[model samples]
Target: MIERKITYQHSFIGQQFIAKLDFTSQYHSLYCARLKSLKYRCISADESGYFSLSEIMEVKVNQSCLIAGIIVCTYADRSSIVEKYISKIGILADRKQSTFYNRRKEEDFIYLEDESGRVRLDLKQYFDWENLITGLVVAVRGVMRENSVLEVIEIFYPSADPPRPLLRKGDEFICFISGIEIGNPSLDPILLNLLSNFLQGNLGNDSAEVAKNIVRFVILGNSLYKADKENSFEQKAYSDISADIVPSISKSLEFFDTFLAELAGILPVDLIPGEMDPSNSSMPQQPLNPYLFPLASRYSALRSFPNPYECKIDGIHILCTSGQNINAIMQFIDTQDPIKILELTMKWRHLAPNAPDALGCIPMQDDDPFIVEDLPNLYVVGGMPNYQKLVTEEGVHCITIPKFTSRQQVVLVNRFTMESETLSFVSVIQGMNNC
Candidate 1:
């Protein structure tokens, strides 16, 4: 096996995501920061001169105007935090619905808000309502109606930043495996062994050659899963519950450590935490603690990064997440296409625009870390329903790697050409030759 001479760098700089948060401040700070970062870009994208940009309060009835602000969508079925909390305590019946959309779509209202004020938006004239969601920074050209509503004529999304140039000489591949779902009782242990053997160059000649080119292996979340559900009694009693649960957790960690150690021993590996992973339950989820994987932590080849991990491999910026952001966006939006949702975030220049609304995030008062300041060469979302890839016009490679447990698939992309292919492993069946 030849050595990989590629340069690798992790883009995080000292606890940006995992930090002391502003618990007192509401989510308003997040939107304020997001709007400030994106306002200039939205202004530049607006080509129509129908009206000059104005503040929400400056709009005159029956006058043409333009404004830039973060989108705010209000649904009839959407419950406030107070409502959900009170209901949980048995004060009121739970009004929470499975989806946030309203049965009578007309009752759902969209508004544009800035620091000045929020104005109701009449999006009936808007064509692409499905693409719109809460927390997006956009510019709208419309006229203020008699009822104090802005009748939107055109909506503008920020122009995507140009993809960084590839600055390396050789070709190598990065393999992304999502939803390993280890410790699931139903999981086929043979498949996990096959993947470990394949990456270690023990499967076959063809597999070994392909494995040699895989410079790195990224396990994209759900690497550990346990189906044991805590009963009501266990939930109330911490000491008794810990006795039963610790063994399960310890065993899961043992298997996960062995799995990761096998791969990291041969090549570099990145462990990204997901919603189900043992990490903070928020956007920009902090990397898994090294102490969790005792054996794998011994190897320098193993590293952990935040959920929305960013880094430069051979000078090409790559952005990845465990699919929490995408999954959150799907609940309120009309489309099931993850690629389309991924592209929407790219155009808006924000990774998880719906953070602090539909998604959980560590609140930052001054900085919105989710903003995509620079375009990456590749964007990867993990644990999707199926494997899909899209190369945007701006030269960004968007990929959704499916859960390995369900699809038995993994993704391999050429670091130079930006081309991708999906590989699946299947068990060989034996023939009844003796009979």
Candidate 2:
């Protein structure tokens, strides 16, 4: 087979040299340029050893530059690129120059020799040669200068490495109430109305309050569902009647007897049997009457800004610093108001154990002081839930109020946290109505 010789001028010294080339068409169209003495240098390694030197000449084409005069050597039968040359003349005469160096070896280096008689060239330091060699091979565009030795004057490494990708943030998850079971008779109507309003998106100013009420409603509903399941007729009957008719009927009187008996052990006073006289009724039965019980008997000075008549009867306030105490309070509330007959509000504080203060004072004439502590705040009232912790930095404490019945309780519950922010509550209520 006939061997081809690749010829190019030794631009470094303005001389001509011929290489017995085994060129691959696969690498055709690559550009090349002459590199001066030390203008650009590369540190490369092969099986023999590692070395560093400047690029003397480059084969320039429209598309890419081919690094020429690279000597290839073979060991046994395996072919590889050669790093060291006994003399410059031998490199120009080598046949397998491309495959002479150990391309896999990290210590191998390729050196470019410039021919004599070329213009003297100014070059960067040896250390910068690494970047220059890579810059040329990657086809980076830069300035060129002709001196005593031909060289790449300016070079870049546009394709020397791969690019990186960007990152993004993650999403968060939250849970909400969907439904509840009603067990407590007093809480039923209020809770029903509240839920109705909530589903309708009419729970104004009371998102949290309504949430609390929903919790209470859920608890009571669960209780009633359980009672109904257990066939607890007496318990079921007590919760079945409306607030107005309940207080006036003989059946209510009997149910109250049983209820007081059931509550005798925990209650402060014995449940007393009262006469069912309509004429003596202090309050008339309204569809919304169930919601008024907590306000009338339990909450003190319970008043809305535009309307002061809002109150929750048979409500309970809970306070505690420890989760255990909070759980205890919730358990107590759950048992006492099984039907969730009371409104519940919870507040958490970092302070040592102390009694909870009234959120507001009830009017003297309308107040039922006996149940003041049991008015508005109910389950998990005074302390953070087991899952929640107190944050002392801003002296910020959390309060949760569950209105077992009234949708308005949602507004009131939120009021516990956001004192005067009427818009949030109003918007929520409006949204509920729209929904």
Candidate 3:
């Protein structure tokens, strides 16, 4: 890691690109934005991270007051409360896996706190704590009770935008496809046939015209599939693995290169690396080494990017990740809904809070890359089996572009309105041919 002094420059009209801190403070601006958007009253936000102590003191004991703060669990902090009143108190917690065969009942003992102080919450009276998770921000109007806890009366979360209309779409569109596994000789011929037909306008209808309007095609990651020679004798020997590399060319790699060169020749192709590629399995994973991609190298339209990447295309701020964060949080949590999880992560305004918890990631020194303080116009993630999209309340496009290996689905996002349409090459080609 390199350490360099940061130079700050003053500018009035334009915004500056900067890093974000995820440990805390990333969601403060959102909390404030939410407060203002909802027209909620704040008595004192001196320490805007949570409700201030001064404000709490102003409320006479036994009187009701509005409280806002980050949620915490007192299960690990208070032994007396846990032992004496464990039956009476319910802790907001997730099922933590202590060992492969053992599941531990852990509690975050939901409390609210800021830099000033901490206040325990009793949501039993009004709100169901079942939906609450650690690190969620909330506002609750409640009466003060003994033992420094709040007796819940009302609870609130920021509003989510209504579902978008299907007709509302962006002006220009970009295509996103991932997990092509390009070089594997065992690649499905029907998959290529469908894509080639679409690209070549063999579909013979409005579908072909729609494909023509696609501004660019993004091969989101995992471009290089393992060579067919992986099972060779040299590959089996630890020291002689490089000997198997003697072939210099395998059926999969050659086919993948040819396909990339053809695609890059037609439209701008952005190649990102996945875990299978020669790159680290961490956030900001390295780009595909161009030396290995000869056919793609010949085309000037081809470009490479890190796993989690950001770029501007067609006046749109686009951010993408290879689905590391969502995969991490999904492991311990029981939820199977990817879109719901994506919405929650965006609501929290951080990319992946559970990184390095169960997910493998490259640790950042000071500023965490996952904290998304300033949102992008369109956010895309790959490495899933089905396409999903939602326009967040903040007007940001949240898209989950599915893996191309199984379903052969691709996402088309309108650049202007940020709406998305999922296209299945297999289904489209089959339908068109049968028609």
What's the CA RMSD for each of the models?
Answer: 3.7, 37.5, 11.2
Name the candidate, 2 or 3, with the larger TM-score value.
3
Each model's lDDT: 0.79, 0.23, 0.59
RMSD of 1: 3.7
Candidate with the larger lDDT of 1 and 3:
1
Top candidate (TM-score): 1
Candidate 2 lDDT by residue in tens digits, 233-309: 11222344356544334443343233323222221110110011111111111111223223232332111110011
Report backbone clashes per prediction.
0, 95, 6
Quote model 3's TM-score.
0.63
TM-score of 2: 0.18
List, residue by residue over 173-194, the lDDT tens digit for candidate 3.
6788887776555556668767
What local lDDT does model 1 show for residue 83?
Answer: 83
Mark the regions of model 1 whose C-alpha exceeds 4 Å error after superposition.
1-15, 21-24, 90-98, 102-104, 165-171, 226-243, 428-435
Candidate 3: which stretches are off by over 4 Å? Answer: 1-50, 53-171, 183-187, 202-207, 225-251, 428-435
